[model samples]
Target: MDVVATAGHVDHGKSTLVRALTGMEPDRWAEERRRGLTIDLGFAWTTLDGGRTVAMVDVPGHERFVGNMLAGVGSVPAALVVVAADDGWSAQTAEHVAVLDALGVRHALLAVTKADVADPGPVLADAVARLAATSMGRVRGLPVAAPTGRGVPELAAALEELLAGLPAPDRSAPVRIWLDRAFTIRGAGTVVTGTLAAGSVAVGDRLVLGGREVTVRGMHALGEPVERAGATARVALALRGVAVEQVARGDALLTPGAFRATSELDVVLTSGDAGTLPAEPVLHVGSATVATRLRPLDAGAARLRLAAPLPLRVGDRVLLRDPGTRTVLGADVRDVDPPELRRRGSARLRGAELAGRAPGGAAAGAELARRRVVRAADFTAMGWPVPADATAVGPWLLAAGLVDELAARVPQVVTRYRQLRPLEPGPPAEVVRRALELPDVDLVPAVVRPPLALREGRVVAAEAALPPAVQRAVDGVRARLAEAPFAAPDANELAAAGLGPRELAAAVRDGQLLRIADGVHLAPGVEREARARLAALPQPFTLSQARQAWGTSRRVAVPLAEWLDARGVTERLPDTTRRLR
Candidate 1:
């Protein structure tokens, strides 16, 4: 994909490098140029040879805009990391690399600017070695000096070589563009722009931003209109229906079903300068930010429980920000297990799950690719970060992974629940998941139906349990039906037994006790037959006559007759009551 971001220390000529590379200046805001720093996000346009073009996001190197930096970096396939040759590497450089790791921006060109002044040897070696320790480790450095255009062509060639060596991004999937800027043009409606992560978008394409559906009336990439734009294209879309304020920087513009959101993701937290965070710390991942509780997966790693669903992915580089301390911690998002998980504390270890995995977060649950993956949407329903896709097999999702680890444990619990409540539907899905310590999504493949089907509101029981007294009352009612079917005990009479209101309610909820109406009880299946016979009668009949036809006494007949009259099933204007014609 054409998405790219710049990284390095503050005032390291990152903005200058972007302005020189794109021809269009990224630092349009006066505040930025005045401060001589990229206080906010800056955008520039560049055209690649063979008609391919790219949009550049020059992220702030200052520690203050770390959140803003995360918002702009992702949704791009490649990055242009700008480190000054003179300054070499600094704290912000490490922080920027950490943020890139958090975002999972892997493909890049390490642009060493200010080569005109500083000795290139030490700066080049240091930046490369430092980057090697983070997600941008393998990036090749290209020394350039804007004053004399030194090494410009070489840098471009190196960028080309890096892009060529990299495998083509998956553009045939759904479209997701995280907004870096959203505004209203005078003539056009509200327009939102960002790096297109995948798939294609065209004018009139229906899209969802932050879950609200909108129509795309216009589309532009590099300021030109085309039928469609795919992965790696920078795009601006004019939206219809949604208000400008409704969309924000952190919100994702996605094709429905492209990604699912969740609050819990299994992440491998790297050990570094950010130090150990409090159990609960604020987290900034991709364009989303929220408070999170971290559980140590192991040394150098941890699982994060966020306050809400964030649009993210496994193997996407992640930057953890501790606002209280004003330091940014770096890590690669090796895994994202959905519906959030209550992670048990321990050191995070590298294993087969993350083996051969990219060091960034791409949610891996993508539609077309089936790498270690899980259904992000299923995780979404479970209060987990929404992942882009769910096309991976059962083992890919954490729940699925746990299910494999705990193989027979799940089936065992399910079997016990079934045995205990043979007649009931089953226990709540959460209950089963909690009892077994398995990822909630893992249960999806093993179960016969969706979790929603099992969680139908009321307390579900496996066995239809009736107390002895309640059962006796039920039997008494059944016997009395033989004598006076119409006058069988109402719910109040049943309540006379030790069974309380709550017990009766539970029975009603379970569909065990069918209370037809007030002061009425017929033989099982008798009500329907009685209604059919009564409906067929040609005219109204007296209560005495009705009793003779149904074979019941006045004790049963009088109220039943009144019930029919009240229901308008039959009219009783005269001495005799009758079923309606």
Candidate 2:
């Protein structure tokens, strides 16, 4: 489905034309019916001659209701400009045209309405020339009259051609629905209606609204319930986990984390009705109306302080209007997340940097990573390529320079850590991650450059050796174990020889000692010697026989047999004896 909005001056026959074509009443309010004027947005739809369904959002044409009109057509990509032949051109018509030009809406059709009241040739020619001078250029127009249904079929054909040329919605992009209505149903908790500008939503998909997540209970597109709906379609979604009182017309339903909602933005301003924007203005973008303060930075650039945070992205075009001053400024969002200006002349430098970015206004790849470490999902949502030159740990993308710098400092960090905590094995992976200011431990191993290694999930210096005190303790343990390779020393004896539990743990971590049992340690190769002796004894042997063969006590023999059995070096029989495999 293609959705287009109706734009024109007051009393331009927009709704009347829609009623004649679709046979449905567009005006829902009794006051509007009584006044015979549109005061709010009205919706209607019709099937074109080519069988294409097009939804029409009929905006109010009165000057007093201009804000309502902007809310209705802010995100609608196409327009149908209605110019009543009897009224010719008017002030509201020019305002609508300026808005379309500011929004960069190029696809449109000019309908010279009320042909039954007067000849439409002069008005049609005048409207075409005026539109051609604006951003819409020359639009195709035809004479239309709702009273006698004159030229209604031709108008539908033109609309179909116009809609067919508009680009298809991006279903793969994140969903951002600018809600226009919210209401409560008897059984359904809350329901909101909006034109799905992009992406697709399904029955069970969760949407973010006002910092809270809501589930989609049901969906209706074109008055038919559906499991999922795509962009360019008007949809009403039944919601769960939210109340009607908590929702409003201008609130947005978005894919969580896909957009950065910030109250401050750095942008490049283009001249509109106002030569330079005032200090305060009314901002209209995607159905949102915000009061903002504009501070000029440099040539064609400024920073905006919005009254509230908006779900904005880089390269979004927004209109700044001051209803009090009657000024308008077209702004292109350059950065959604900008740093605070705390230093002298920082705003100027920031403006220069923003000006240096590409026309799309998004940050460069390296600059994006520098702002903060981003994941693959962030890259996809921002339409940035996953950088190939950077180090990727799991889903994160780290700056190559940052990774290299961290890698270069690992050896120093590990040495300092070991010196401070000599009793421990080494710094844990998390410690290394924090020392480098990384987001998580996933990137720690990747930061270990050549000549550096990670052992037991701890960063280790490749050529690391024990400190002097630990080295002396290890030497005492080695000498004692070598004299009696199988007769392990007791804990008290080892502690007396300068090898305590901490020292033993360090030796084991460094691969210099193998712990056979509690309070029992051996030289690294002593276990092999014991295993060889046990195998030489017999095919099946008792624990006592093994202790005699290895010349050790029950403490060492029991753990040795069990350790050997665990390594598949020997098997234990059902009768509680051991056998070589």
Candidate 3:
């Protein structure tokens, strides 16, 4: 199926042409039929000679309704540009053609209506010449009088040929349905209609709108209920979760999580100079019209800050219009997620950086290079394929040089951490992640290099050694314990020997000392010696017997007996006597 939007002057017979082709009323409103003018978008469809289905979106052509016209044509792939023979070319006709050109609509056909009232040859030639100057280059034209049906067959044949030459739509592309109509049906909750330009939609599909997920309760194509519909087809979706007042024309039904809504973007002007644009303009894309502030970056590139967020991506074509003058310019989106211009001359530098790049996946490498590190999901949301050379560290995609640079800094970071706190082994993963400015702590392990290893959830030096002062204090304590294995030093005695809590903890971590309890420090092998001595006593001895056997005072004996019990070296009986395990 091919959906084509009609464009031309107000009274040039755009609706008339569609009505004649489809044998159906293009105008739905009574006011439109009575006034003999198209006030809003009208829809009709027909089967061409070769059994090809064609849907027509009849758009209003009055200068006042240009917004409506843009909404109708934004998502369609082809157009039927109507020109009246009696009125050769008109103001709305020129504006409509300009809009199509700005939107990069390349496939179109010209219909010279009112052929019976005047000679069609002159108007057809003139209209064809004007269209050739724009993006719709040299469209095929014919004369047709809708009322009398003169040359109608030839026009339909021309349309069929034009539709035949269009590029095939990508059914696998992410779905973005730019709604043209939103209202409530008698039984259905809310219904929205749009031309599905790419991808496919099926009943029961979940679509996103305004950050909320809505289910497709029902669907129709060409007014017939269908379970599924693909690209280039006109579709109406019955939505389950939203009210009619909540949705309106120009809203979009999107594939969930497939897009990132952005308020600021950088674009390359495909048509007009950026310096001549208005400071504030309206941007139209995919049936969405948003007020924007344009900041000229260069002669051909600029930045746009939108009043409302839109789900935008690189390579998306958009039309910027100065509402005051009704002049439009075409732009190709270059960056959806742009860097902030915090410093002076940053905008100019940004423009220079973007000058040489194209849009879409072709520019992915340049994007990754500029960002250095980005979440892989962000790239997917922005509609850019991840670069092949990017290194995946957990959920992050790192530039080729970034991994090496981060790895190179790890050893220095750990060394500095150790220098600041001599007793500590290494920094925790979160501390190292923050020091490296990495997005995820899990990525720290990926960038860890030789001489630095991840151990016990902390980045550790391969040969962890205490400082000279700490090692000297530990040696003094070890010598004291060697002389009297059961006589653990008191807190004041250990403090006088320059061993604080941190120094003691560091010694324990290095296996130089064992902590029997708070304020009780012993040598590493002293616990085994105490347990051996206790075993020599009669089985199930009292605490006093164990204390005498070890020759330690009550201060050391209680903690030692408890530590032994906790270590499964001994168990206490109901009578307060202990025995070895």
Best by TM-score: 3
Candidate 1's C-alpha runs over 4 A off are 49-51, 102-104, 270-275, 297-303, 312-317, 325-327, 330-581
Query: Which tens-of-lDDT digit does each residue in 1-581 have in candidate 2?
Result: 89999999768988898898788888889998889899998998878889999888999999899888989988898999999999999989988888888888889999999899999999999999999987689899999988898999898888999989999889988899998889987887799999998999999999999899999999988778999999888999999989999998789999987877879888776554233567888888988899988877765778899999888877788998878754556778877667789999987887787767743313546455555567766654553445556666798877657777778888888878988987665799999989888878888887787566888898776755777877887887788778888878888888877887788888888888898778888888875787789868867889899889988898888888898888888899999988888
Query: In candidate 1, what are the lDDT values of residues 1-581, reduced to their tens digit?
Result: 35567777785888877766667778768988888878788887776653445677888899888777777775556777778878878888877776666555567778889998897778888888877776666778888996677887687666656667666767676676777788998777799888776677888888888778899988888777766787777788899988888877777787765565657766555546224676777776556667888766544556777887776655555667677765566566655552333454213333324334443234333311332334445444222343433334443454324334444454566667757754444566666656755445445445423222444532233344555656666666667766755555555676675445555544455554544554455555555555775655556666676777777667666776676667666677655656563
lDDT of each: 0.65, 0.83, 0.90
Worst 10 residues of 3 by lDDT: 353-362
Tell me the tens digit of each residue's lDDT in model 3 across 175-212.
99999899888887799999999999999999998788
Candidate 3: stretches off by over 4 Å: 148-150, 472-498, 511-516, 520-581
Best-to-worst order by lDDT is 3, 2, 1
Estimate the Cα RMSD of every predicted model relative to the unseen true structure: 9.2, 3.7, 3.5
